[model samples]
Target: MTKEFLLECERKLAKSYVCTALGRDDDSIAITKEIAKDIAFEVTNSIHPISMETAPYVVAALRTLANGIEKEMNPLDKEIARALQELMGRFQFVKEEVKVDL
Candidate 1:
């Protein structure tokens, strides 16, 4: 990815982080979807290196976000949480694959 694209992704993720931290469920969900889109773009285009080192931090943030919203979550939010969890699973799989390759 270009510097601009990465910066934009960082901005979106930051916004989502703040929204989640502040208990803005609707905004957090929207921003999380946007971040997911960014991930999709990175996956499809293969322009940027995926940082395995960041996986743990991302997973932790997602867990915290999910837990914070668990009480008020509707079906859609639950589905989104499932999707995020799946993404973390994929990250773990990739990390293991890399370790095996090494």
Candidate 2:
């Protein structure tokens, strides 16, 4: 689910990161597995402390970014914004049933 997005992000970053330094990783990242995955996990998170089991935070961070991108400057990226919006829209938050007496 969310993991797919993270992996995809890593792959994309790996290809694009021509020169950067992070932890043990440096220079051009030809190896697209561990180093890029580490970058994805560390960079995408916002609230939660960076860790391996931080997929929810990763998704949250991406959602926040996507939302801002869609709402900002009339959205230069119409197609990408639409795709992300549609995909995120499919999942609806569920509310718990509750009974109250006044």
Candidate 3:
């Protein structure tokens, strides 16, 4: 995907994150569905190279969207959250090695 396309997907996911936070499950579901393709796309840090920059934000958004859903199972919400959680794994988190000279 082009830079603009990935950016657009991130923007939409951010909106969905806010909607979910405000308990607007319906709206969140709609927005998530709109970018379901991007979410499902094979994105890896080695290939997509967004892990260091965009991955954290995307994972946080997905986490918020996944956690903010109501207890009762809304079929669509459940599926969206599931897919988002899966997508989160695709962005290989960057780990920094620390050195201590103590």
Candidate 4:
């Protein structure tokens, strides 16, 4: 039952992400990317140092999505992309602290 619950949750989250990406405004898109970065940070922080399973998947997805987005972005969206990149850079600094402590 718990596994089913988790699967359903993931499905719903995927749909939400798709909708958010398709949103009409730059703010909405930026918000969506920001939310994704937060989720990635949480997943990375929660994992044990020895367990390399989830972080690679999360990072790969982010890089792939970001590349796809950058290729198609208009000027307004370029600003949003810049903001997300800055945010991700800040997050990377925190991630470094975690790595150093490990």
Better by lDDT, candidate 3 or 2: 3
Candidate 2 lDDT by residue in tens digits, 1-102: 268767766676665454444443533434534443444445434334434455566668878975776676455567645654455454444333334434
The lowest-lDDT stretch of 10 consecutive residues in candidate 3 is 42-51
Best by TM-score: 1
- Candidate 4 C-alpha lDDT tens digits along 1-102: 256655654665576567666774565555456565655556555543533455687678768976897989899979966876676666543433223434
lDDT of 1 by residue, 24-92 (tens): 989987887677767665754452333576557666875686588786889997887688867644542
Residue 59 in candidate 4, Cα distance off native in Å: 1.2
Q: Which whole-number lDDT from 0 to 100 does residue 58 have in model 3?
A: 66
- The residue ranges of model 4 lying beyond 4 angstroms of the native Cα positions read 1-50, 91-102
Cα lDDT listed for each candidate: 0.68, 0.52, 0.68, 0.61
RMSD of each: 10.8, 12.5, 11.6, 8.8
TM-score of each: 0.42, 0.27, 0.39, 0.35
Which stretches of model 1 miss by more than 4 angstroms?
47-102
TM-score of 3: 0.39
